[model samples]
Target: MHKYQKLNIQKLYQIYIYLTIRLLMNVMWIVLAIFLIILIFERVAERLGIDRWYKLSSIGWIFLSIYWLSSFIAYLDTDDFVNMLLTLLAAIFSFIIAFKIIIDNRKYPWKNITLWVTISILIIFPFYKIPILRDFLIDMVANHTLFILSSVFNASGEIITDATIILNGFPVSIVIGCTAIESMAFFAGLILCLNAPLKRKIIALVFIPVIYIANLFRNAFAIYAYGNQLFQFGIIGTAHESFFWAHNVIAKIYSFLVVVILAYLTFKIFPEFLTLIEDIISSFKKDVDK
Candidate 1:
């Protein structure tokens, strides 16, 4: 046991030394790259004027990245005044944090930093557009799911041509923004951070449409129920209460439940899959030793 401990200690020491050298080299490269970029910018500015060059500096690049991220997130589903205000506030906070990271690292040249910044921006753009995508995908899923559900429920009515459901003279349109695309986008970021496998990440991608489709049908059915509310609203005797308001809440609740259920399933299955992977690695190591 003492000899085993010594071996482990020696292995760890070697790894530590190797990593220390790698870290030092990376830092040196970053510093050198930054200095070279700044020198080039300074020379260019000498000919182009200080003001114009300053606008294209490391600081300016950070500001642009921050602005782009903030503006993109801020633009999603700003329908409700309260939601619009909240999104704007969140965008501002996100920008500040991202900006600080870049500014604090401004010792590096703009060019070296651009790769990382640009890569992040590219990654985030698709997710930022998810709310909009959810709307369209949800509507498609909901409308189709409603048709299926209608068949199951043995309900009879003209299926409206667009994404609208008409019942008892009440028509409700399933807007794409009403889908859970935004929430899935948020969860996608979390899963990505967890370093989930490509297959598992693909599962999350699949869940987006599943959640959206479930939401779409939930909305459609709620509208159907709203139209047939002679059974439900008869208890309240509508003096023109918010048409479909209760049903809208129901649909939203159903979508939330669906998201929770899918997320839970993903979490459960992913850990088991990881365990399987670990087992495989163990088997491979044993084979190598043999």
Candidate 2:
């Protein structure tokens, strides 16, 4: 009985340690996110010649306070309502700070930085927590892609379900990441970051849908290649699989080529974009040479 008791105690201790570690990890992630935001704000402020230590410090404190309060509410297990409310308040606060910074630094490239950061956040984080919107977007992309594939392969493919397609009995699932939203976001960010006219920006935005259409072609090609065994090979009675080539290599190459062509055309339309790209490339080369 004593041995069993001791074992139970050890197991309980292990579980306690695990929970403690998990809690700490969660806290660390929150703190790290806050720290990064503060750091980016300070860097942008310094660049814009608005480096007020007191204001930045206050902003950091506000973020830290929000994080701590939310953490406390979460620990109490009193629903996620309070936590979400606090998060919304914190976002508003951050936005106000960003707006003020932009207003005070109209001469600097604050607008570009703001646009880039905002679009990046929207792309990287699923702030839109609506499941229906997400599902609808994925379903649309998947269905359209499957339709294209069917046309190309003479109706050899069908959509099995939302965001999933079956071609020649091989199933492919399209997730949110596969919808090319990130690439569109990147293109939008680039266009907004460039020192271009409103007309050019609008024109660039008009072409944003082209990325989604290109992604459809990319998906169709990959699915068709995989289904038709376009790259399969064998050597001396040994069959070598080409799934990796079809799925990874072909998909990536197609996407990269499409983006490159689109970017080239866009840069031609907006010469400032080409200059920005050249500057970035030169700076990167210099850094590498160092």
* Model number with the top lDDT: 2
- What lDDT score is found at residue 161 in candidate 2? 64
Whole-model alpha-carbon lDDT for candidate 2: 0.64
Instruction: Please report the TM-score between candidate 1 and the true structure.
Output: 0.45
lDDT tens digits by residue: candidate 1, 89-172: 654643443343343433232233343333333344453446665455656655675675577555554457566666667766
List residue ranges in candidate 2 displaced over 4 A.
Answer: 1-49, 52-114, 127-129, 234-242, 281-290
Q: lDDT per prediction?
A: 0.53, 0.64
lDDT of 2 by residue, 44-136 (tens): 767888655223333433444454555555646543343346556655655554444433423233334444545544553452345877787
Consecutive 10-residue window with the lowest summed lDDT within model 1? 105-114
52 Cα displacement, candidate 1 (Å): 21
Output the worst ten-in-a-row residue range by lDDT, candidate 2.
235-244
